[model samples]
Target: MAFLLFLLCLILVIFTVTTMGVPNIPSLDPVNRFLKGQTDVSKIVSSDFQEFFYDQTLDHFNYRPESYTTFQQRYYINYKWWGGASNNAPIFAYLGAESPIDDALWSIGFLPENAPRFNALLVYMEHRFYGQSNPVGSMEAPNMVDAMEKSLENPDTRGYFNSAQALADYAELLLYLKNQLQAHNSPIIVIGGSYGGMLASWFRLKYPHIALGALASSAPILYFENLTPPDGYYSVVTQDFKEASQNCYTTIKQSWDVIDQLATTPSGLAYLSQKFQTCSPLSNADELKNYLKSVYSNAAQYDAPPNYPTARICQGIDGASDATDILDRIFAGVVAYMPGMSCYVTSPEVVSPSESVSQTSIGWEWQTCSELLIPLGITSEDSMFQSLPYDANVFIDNCVRSFGVGPRPHWVTTYYGGQDIKLILSKFGSNIIFSNGLRDPYSIGGVLENISENIVAIKTTEGSHCLDILSSGEADPEWLVKQRKDEANIIDRWFAEYYRNFRLL
Candidate 1:
C-alpha cells in the first residue's frame, strides 16, 4: 500500500500540462513534426533568408466588402546565391504548410545547399493563420497558447483557411516577386516536402504559367479518394517494426489487449498507470493507446539512418529479460521517446490525433475537416494497431463535434482527378518530379513510377519523409546521396532548357 501510495503521488507531482511541449505540437510534414519544439532556430546549421511581409487578400474567391480586408502575410527571401535578372538565374519558392515558416527556413536543407549552383533566388511564403502571417491580432504574440486555442476554435476566422485561398496567395506572391526582381525570364521551380509538397505539385498543375516544375517529397496526394488502399499507412508502420524484430512487432500487437484487460479493474489500472508513469493514475485505456499509436506513427515517419527510432524502440522491447512482463518491455519502448518523463502526458493535448503533430492543432484539424480528408485505418492482423475500420460516420462525428466543421470527403479526388493519375498527368504534366521512399507510410500514396519523360518519379527503398531534402553528409546512405545528385541533375536540365529557349528568342 505504501509503494502504491508513493507511485500515485509521483504521477501528480512530476508533470504539468505543457501546451507547447514536444508531444503536443502537430506538424504538416514529418520533417517539421520530428523537429517540433525541439530545435533552436538560430542554432540550426542553415543559411539565412530575410523576413518580409506582403499585403494579402483575406478571401481570394469572395468579393464581399469583408473579403477585401487585407492581412499582413509573412515571407522570406535570400539573394546571396541569386545570379541577377540579366543572367536569367532560376527562382525557387518553398511554400510553407501548417507550421511557422521559421521552422522550414532552418530545416529545409535542399534550397540553400543547391541555390548557389543554380544561382537561384530562394523564397518562403508563410501560410495564412499560421505563424506571423495570421489574421488573428495576437497570433504572433508570446502568449500563443491562448491565442491559438481561441483562433482555432472560432470557425469564422478559419473560414478562409483553405487550399484554394493559400494557392492563390502563392500565385500572386510569386508574380509580385518576379516583377519586383525583374526576373520574368527566370524559370520558377517550386519545391516542397510533405503537405507543402502537395501544394508544389498542385501549383504546377493548376498554374503552369507561374512555375516551370515542382519537386514534391513524400507528398501523399493520392491518399485521398480511395486512390490508395486504406491499410497502406498502417501496413508500412507495422512492417517497419516487424523488420526491426518480429518479437517487437508481436509484443506491440499483443500489448493492446493486455492494456485493455488491465484497465478493467482499479488495482489493475493503478498498477498499469504506475508502471507506465502516467501523469495521472489510469482511469481508462484510451489515453495509453493514443500515446502508443502516436509513437509508432512518428517513428515510422522519420525512420532515418544513424540510430533510427524504431531500432531504438525495438531494442528496448526486445532486450527485456524474461523476468519482466510484456507491459514493462512496452513501457521500455515508450521510455525510448520519453527518456526523462517521470509521468507521461497521455492527455488529448499530447496524443490526440490532431494535436500530436502540431504546436497548435486547431488550423490543421480544420484543414483535415475541410478538405485534406485522407482516411487511414488498421484492420488486418498485418498491422500492430487496433482493428479500427475507416468509418466516415465516426470521423465526421468527431470532426463536427470538435471543430463545428465537417469534412468534404470526395471533394479533393473529384477536383484533383486521382482515379487515373498516370494517364491524367502523363498527357498534361511535364518537368515535375515526384520523389517517394517506400518506407515512408505516406509514400504508398505517392507517385512511385514515371508518368512521362519529363514528369519524373524518383523512388528509394531506404528513404523516408523528405530524405532527399535533408542535409547531406558522409554518413548518408549511398542511395540517399545519389537521390539528391539525380534531383540536382534533373533541375540542371530544366534550367538548361529554359536558358536555351530564352536565347532562341
Candidate 2:
C-alpha cells in the first residue's frame, strides 16, 4: 500500500511536469531567433542545393475570426537555396499536396535541379484534421480519419471544405512569414500541384499582393456544383481510350464499343455491381443503378486525349475477365492521394441503399472516371477522381470541397460554357501563365488556346501537365531550345516586365 501510494505520487509529478512546465506553443519565432546568426546566409546561397533539417518547434500564428471557433495551428519553416542567390532572385514558396511539406517524396525537383535562381521555402502546415492540426479532441477518438468520414457522411458538413477558407489560412501564413522573416522586398512565387494547385490559384486570386507570380500545374480549378458522375466522367474516359488506341494503334482501336457491350452483359454488370457493392456501402440495386447513372452524367474528364493507357481500360469487356477486370487492374496501378485513410469509406456505419448508392455511385463514377482516363491524356489534370470500391464519398467530398472554397465560378460548367479560363484570366489579367501540353487529354491545348490578350497561354508540343522535362525529352536539342527553353524564359521575362515595367489595374 505504501509503495502503491508512492508510485501514484510519482506519476502525478510527471504529469504535472509535462503539462505545466512547457506551454504548448506552436510557432516559429522562437526557433527563428535561435538560428538568427548561427547559419550563414551568405554561404547558403543558391537553388541547386536542397537540404533538410528539423525545426523542433516553430511558431504558428493562430487566429480566429468572429465567424469560426478559435483553433491553434503550427507552421514549420523549411528553407533551401535554389542556387547561389543572384542579386535579386525571387523566393519560390512551394506548397505540397495533402502530404506534409517535410516529406522528401514531394520534392520540387520533379525536374533536374540546375543552377538555382530562387529560394524554395516549404511551409509544413497541417491540413485541417490532419497530422497535428486537429482542432477538436484527440485524433484517436473521432480522429482525423474518422472525422473526415463523418463529415463526408453528412452533406451539411461537406460544404465547409471550400477553397476560400483554405486561401484564408494560406494568406494568414504568408502575412505571418513576411513579418517574421522581414522579407518585404523579396518577390514571392507560389507553386503547387493537385490540391496544392488549387491553393496556389486561390492564393494568387485572393492575395495577389503577397505573390509576385504563380505556377499552378495539374490543378483542378473546377470542383464544385456542376460536377456530376458516370457519363460526365466517362466522356473523358472514352476520349482517353480513343487517344491511347491511336497511340498503340495496332493494339486497341475499335475495341471500346465491344468492351462497352461486355460491360452491360450479365457477367459484366454483375462484376461491376459486385465491385461497387464490395467497395461501397450499397445494399440495393436501385441505389446502385442511381449511383451508376450519376457517375455517367457528371464526373467525367473533358480535356484528356482519346488514347491514353489508363483510359483504355474502360474499353475492355465486362465478363468474369473482361473490361471491368481491366479497369480493376488499371485502378490498382494508379497513385491515389489518400492511402492511409480510405477515400471510399466516408462513414463508420455500413452505407444504406439510398444514401450508399447515390453517394457511392457519384464518388466512384467521378474517381473511377478520372483514374481510368486522365492519365491517358498527354498532360494530367491537376486533380484525378477515382471511385474507391468503398463508400467514401462523404470523406472525399469533404476533403475536396471543404478543404477550400474551390475555384471561383467553378471549372465544371465553365469548361462546357467555354468561359472557365476566360473568366479567371479576365479577373487576374496578365499576371497568370496557363501552360499545357499539346497531347494533353484534359484541356488538350484548349486552355492555352483560349488565352485572351492579358493572360499568356503557353503550349509546348512536349510540355504535358507542367512536366516540361518529360515532354521535352523527345524533341531535338535545337527544337527544345527553340520551343521549351523559351517557355520558362518567357515566364521569367514576364515577371521582370510585370514587376519592373507594368502596373496593376
Candidate 3:
C-alpha cells in the first residue's frame, strides 16, 4: 500500500509540473528538489529575463519601454508543498526599496520556514531615474529637472514617473510571470517598505484579484502635500529642540525663556542675522536674505525622534558659538547647510519648473522647519507639521492627488495610520496590520486607535522603521527576537488558515 501511494504521488508531481509549463525535474536528482529529512517542504527556483513591459501612463493610448534595459531582471520563486509529493505551492512577492537586493533577501528571514511552499519574487526595477533606470537624455540636474516639470504638466509624459503607473507595471509583470510559470492558481503575498511600501498598498487596491495579503511598512499613503512640512512640523521642531536642550544642556534649558525674549532685541536680531549670513547658501547679501525669506515658508516638521533623528537637528554642545547648533551648522557660512547633505539654493537658469515646484513646495517645507524655525524659536505658519496626525482630506489632497499618476482608483489600501486603516478596513472589508516599533517616534499607538474587525495592529517592543531593525545584539537584540517570532507566527498562521482557503470570489 505504501509503495502504491509513493507511485501515485510521483505521477501527481509530474502532472503538476507539466501543467504549469515548468521545466521537468530529472529522475537522477529528484530527491534534491523534494523535502527529505527536514519537516518543511519547499524549493527555490531562479530565473533571468531580458525585459518586461511596463505601463508609462494612465492613458491607454501612450506606452514606452523602460529606457535602461542593460540589467537583466532576475527573481527567485519559493515553493511550499503540501504533505503530498505533488508540486503545489503558494507565492509571496516582495518589493524592496532603494536598498540592494541582497539586503531585501536578508529581511525575508522573518518568514516562516516550516510553512507550506511559497514563491519569493524580486524585481530590480531601480527607482525611476536612480541608478541604471535614468531615462532622461541628459544626467545633468538642469535637464533632469526640466524633464520632471514637463512630466507633471503633461499627463502623457507624467505616466512613467508616478506611483500609480509603477503599481500598474507590477501588476502586468505578475500576469506575465503567471503565464510564464503556469502558476495562475497559486496565491500571492505582496510586501514592501518605505517607497516600496507605498507601491505595495497601491498594488493591493489596484489589483485585488491577484493578491491574498499585503504588508506595507513605513508607507506614506496620503498625497505628497501631507508628507510635506506644515506649521505643526515647526511646533514639533520647537518642542524637540526645547526638550533636547533641557535634557542635554542645562544652561539652554534654564534660559530657554531668555532665548525667546532676546528675539525682541535689536542686538539679538543683529547677532542672529550675522549667524544666518555666515551659513547662507550664497555669500552675497541679497541672496542671503532671499534664502532666509524662503526658509520661513518651507520649514520641516520635527514630529518625533524616529522621523527627526537628533543628529539631523540639535547639536550635542553648549554655547552660542558651538558648531553643533542648528544656526551655526545651517548658516555658519555663505551657503546654507541642511540635513541629508542637501542644499536650499539652486541655479535658477537650469532648474525645471515642475521639479522646482516639487522641491519648493514639498521638500522645502521639511527642510525649512528642521533647519530654521526650531533653532531660531520662531513660529511656524503651517500647523500640520507639529504632530503626525491623520487628516483624511489632507492626505487625499496632498499625498494621493499630488504624487499619484493619472486618476484616482475606486479602491484604496493604507497601512500607516490606525485611523486611516480603521476607516478603510471598515468600508472596504480590507486586511490592515500595523507592524510597529516601541522606539519608533512616529505613529505611536496611531495604528490602533480606530481599528476595524478586518484590521490588526501589532506592536514590537524593539521594532523600528517598519520593523526593519532586530532587537538582539546589534542595535536592539531583545526586540529583534520578538520581531522574528511575531513575523514567523503571523506568516505561519496566515498560510495555514487564510492562504490555504483562498479562492477567486
Top candidate on lDDT is 1
Local accuracy of candidate 1 as per-residue lDDT tens digits, 282-371? 566766776677777677767776556678789888877463689999988877744654466466555321234343355666787788
The per-residue C-alpha lDDT of model 2 at residue 198 equals 49
211-234: candidate 2 lDDT, tens digit per residue = 766665544343233332212222
For candidate 3, write residues 183-243 as lDDT tens digits.
6765566766544665665567567787666666544443223232233223433444455
In model 3, which regions exceed 4 Å deviation?
1-90, 96-119, 123-155, 159-161, 222-315, 318-424, 437-446, 459-464, 467-473, 502-505
User: How many collisions between residues are there in candidate 2?
Assistant: 80
- Badly placed stretches (over 4 Å) of model 2 are 1-77, 82-89, 96-115, 119-132, 137-143, 150-160, 220-233, 246-428, 438-441, 444-446, 450-454, 460-487, 498-505
In model 2, what is the error at residue 189, expressed in angstroms? 1.1
What C-alpha lDDT values do all the predictions have? 0.75, 0.36, 0.37
TM-score of 2: 0.52
* Per-model root-mean-square deviation over C-alphas: 6.8, 16.1, 16.6
